[model samples]
Target chain A: MNNYSTFGTALHRLAILCYVLFALFPLFWLLKVSVTPNDLLYSEGVRMWPSRMSFEHFRFVLAHSAFPVFFRNSMIVAGATAVIVTLLASLSGYALSRFTFRGKYWLVALMLLTQMFPLVMLVAPIFKMLSPLGLTNSLTGLVVVYTAFNIPFATFLMQSFFDGIPKELEEAAKIDGATQFMAFRQIVLPLTLPGIAATLGFVFTAAWSELLFALMLISGNSAATFPVGLLTFVSKFSVDFGQMMAAGVLALIPACLFFLFIQRYLVQGLTAGAVKG
Target chain B: MVFDATAGFPESRRRSLVDRITRHAEPYLYTAPALILIVTIMLAPLVLGLSYAFRDVHLLNPFSGGYVGLDHFRTLYDDDNFYRALRNTLWWTGASVLLQFVFGLILALLLDRPFAGRAIAQALVFLPWAVPTFLTGLNWAWLFNPVIGPLPHWLYALGLMNEPANILSNPQLAMWGPIIANVWWGIPFFAITLLAALQAIPRDLYEAAAIDGAGAFRRFTSITLPFLAPTIAITVLLRTVWISNFADLIIVMTSGGPADRTQIVASYIFTQAFRALDFGYASAIALVLLVLLLAYSMLIVMLRQVLMDRA
Candidate 1:
């Protein structure tokens, strides 16, 4: 029995180590290639680490490229979408959680159906619609579209979080002459901070990652998000490996940081959702 | 805030007609912003897109956007690429979802076991999920490059490839490039969800099973699989639908291919709209994909219902 248990422990650790390597290898390779000197890029090839490294690619990308504009545009779009989606989702989610009104079932069905259908269907029509409003080719348009696209999922996520809280807290606040909205704002919202953070983090990453609509809607480099910008880089300088990987590393930073910060809450939120479902 | 005059008023102090109306209108008020946005930004566009299927809405043609009356669909019926895309979508969605789910389940099971350094391990393993989809596609594309990446070299060394070459340029093996990247990116999602579901399973049942002399495999089958069934069903169902629509990796990695070998319906529609500048044909293809997806979803839901009834 002792020998068997020891074998199990070794196997478990080995399995975990394998997973960690698989997960991190691609990212590590990206970093490795980013810092590799131009002279040794191809010569070093499959070497786990190049003997020499430099930040020349990063410097070039930051100084000479249109990446700064793309980065700023993505930030604006993602940040605004995150804030707006969370706010709207909170209210709508609270409604779904607390009220039993007519059309609630249909509302949920609509949201679920939205998740199923292809968003690509809307790209052409949205471009046409927004073109008339002068909303195409702008950061604001991206924000508006991302928020609407994300609301259904965000609302469902927020609803699950709201569902985790007991009803009595809001009821107690209401008994003390607080309005329902006040009870929600002052009483429940504070307790649901983690859920809110998770929602914001999720929306932020999704908005930042949106490509197809971003591609069609924004043409010029001035308004391009990271994905569109990256594609342009690939198509333009198909051989500039170091600069592209460097840019990719830069793009990875914010999303990964936010993800690490809020992933715990996400798991907790989903656990609640899983149980309820 | 001022518009909602009765918003601040208590029920006892304001039992008047305005208060009653306000009380009844509260939920609608809460949901109104989201509903309006969804109707305009999502549902409205969805309806317009449906109409574009039957209209001539070429982007560059100033004379386009007229009623074409199923002309695009008639063309699509004979389009060999459309048929190829439909077939590829099935292969792509099926392979990606299956591999993601399998690896994810294994990872979840592994993590469910308590161990030293589990926190850091968990974080690292889940990091790939945070990589932007475009970057994921690009990084994987580079990884399969014979010159820069080690994958082709490793495959060659392992007797897998005849020589070091970019798989993205291989017509016969091109689809695998996007599918592999997809599996890598998507496994984290399935892992996270399944891990949550796994943690929610009552551990005392496992203890009880072990106490009854049930082995590990036996306990897993008797408890884990059954408890995981609902989550699996829902996640797999949603994932099937979502992945079928996903085309970023394919578009970035292969642009639907050396010979359209990797062309799935989602990416094919995107190509038509953005590359061909033919919105009418794109919408027509999208309409078909949507109908097919709806049918697929309905079939699965009915199958699940029948399975539940039998159980």
Candidate 2:
């Protein structure tokens, strides 16, 4: 029976391996297309490795194309949104998780209500509202829209994080003659590092890749993000798969680096060994 | 502040009053940033959009438009395009969320047990979630390119279709194509959430089942499932709300195109305001969409509560 179970475990391991490969194939394909020399792209006939690989597309995208500007714009928008949304969400999440006020339930109900609407529905009205203020063509406008869209979800995220922390810690701090602000800043915020990191990463990635609002709000190259930059690969006639794939690969670095930086916080449990078993 | 507010009261009154006020006030202060932003950015726009629904305004007459009081809604109700957008939006949300959750759960379950190379496997499975949506959409676009795409080329080679075809140009299939991409993009979220929940479940229950001579299927149903119910339900609720509001995927992949066949409420509303310059009517349509969204969310919350109670 033990031997049979060992066999079963091995089979399970194999199954997991297959599943993982399947899940990652698209990413593998992304890397493949990004590196395959354009001359050999079609000639290679679905070969996993091209006879020759080139960084020429990346070189052109970085040096010759407007991709660098798009990259800079994306970083600014995403970074600002992440910081702004995380700050707001941490505060709001704390409120939702801890408080009982006159309109607490209704406030939550309203926030949830805001999330239900397809944001596309608000696009025109938002543009109309922003256009007159000369905010439509600016990165600030994109950041504002992304922050608005991300905060509700990020708030929920933060609230759950705060919820995971013990209220006893804050209570103990208050008894020690700490103000609410002091207790939160000194005690609670440190414990919520994991949650803060998660929120930051979530909002950062969200703002980074946001295409719809960027496409609609930003009219020119000055404010355009990488997603809109990818669209430039498609003119009226044919799509440039090689350069587009290369650009897609390049656009991935910031998101990858952001995750790498945050992965520690993403997995860590700041509340670990805090409370008694 | 609470102590100050209660300092005027008698000794007995002061303690209770201050405690009460502080208990109530703390949450507000903690959540003030989120509240202020949500109110100003999200709620304000919602209110502003609703007001636009009542006006007879065009793009040129943003502030000077006359209040028409539901005329735009009436036009929306009478419009065939609205119905099509409504139906497509429903289909997009329903199909995308259901498939994503189902596939995600399956993947999560398959990967739940500790095994060799589990960490690497988990990372690879979660890769799609880390990659940006724009890149995924762009990559999928390349994969769907008829002449150049591997899918059509392989299909043609296998005699599945007559020629390399532009799937996005087909009115009927464009929405589904984007839905597929969206589902692929979202599956990792479901997988991660469910996996977290699954990991939290105690191993003792499975041990109890093993002692009872329960097979894998029996253990899953009897021990694993009932425990994971709340997490699964919440995951479904979150995914449904999110998928329903998905405008980005459609924007990148289809743009509600090939003769408005893929026009979900979000994309269609965008066209009205940004492309068509119909601000008043667009706002009216947005209002309707918001109401429907609220109704759906309420249903999910209520359903979740009912299920939690039962479980």
- TM-score of predicted structure 1, chain A: 0.96
Tens-place lDDT digits, model 1, residues A1-277: 9999999999999999998999999999999999998999988779999899899999999999999888999999999999999999999999999998989999988887787789999988999899989899998999999999999999998988898899999999988999888999999899989889889999999999999999999998888999999999999998999999999999999998997897666566677776777
lDDT accuracy of residue A154 in candidate 2: 91
iRMSD for each candidate structure, in the order shown: 1.2, 3.6
Q: Which structure among the candidates has the greatest TM-score? A: 1
Residue range A1-277, candidate 2, lDDT tens digits: 8999989877877767776776667767777887887788887766777788888778877888888999898989999999998987888787777766778888788777777666666666677677888889999888888888898899888888888889999999989988777888899999999779878988998888887778778887888888887775554224456676788888888787876665434323321312211
Q: True interface contacts reproduced by each model, as a fraction?
A: 0.83, 0.62
Off by over 4 Å in 2: A1-11, A95-101, A167-177, A233-238, A260-277, B1-30, B60-64, B298-311
> Candidate 2 deviates by what RMSD?
4.3
- Clash pairs for candidate 2: A91-B31, A92-B31
* Ten-residue stretch with the least lDDT total in model 1 chain B: B11-20
Residue-wise C-alpha lDDT for candidate 1, range B57-158, written one tens digit per residue = 999999998999989989999999999998999999999999999999999999999998888898889988999999999999999998789999999999
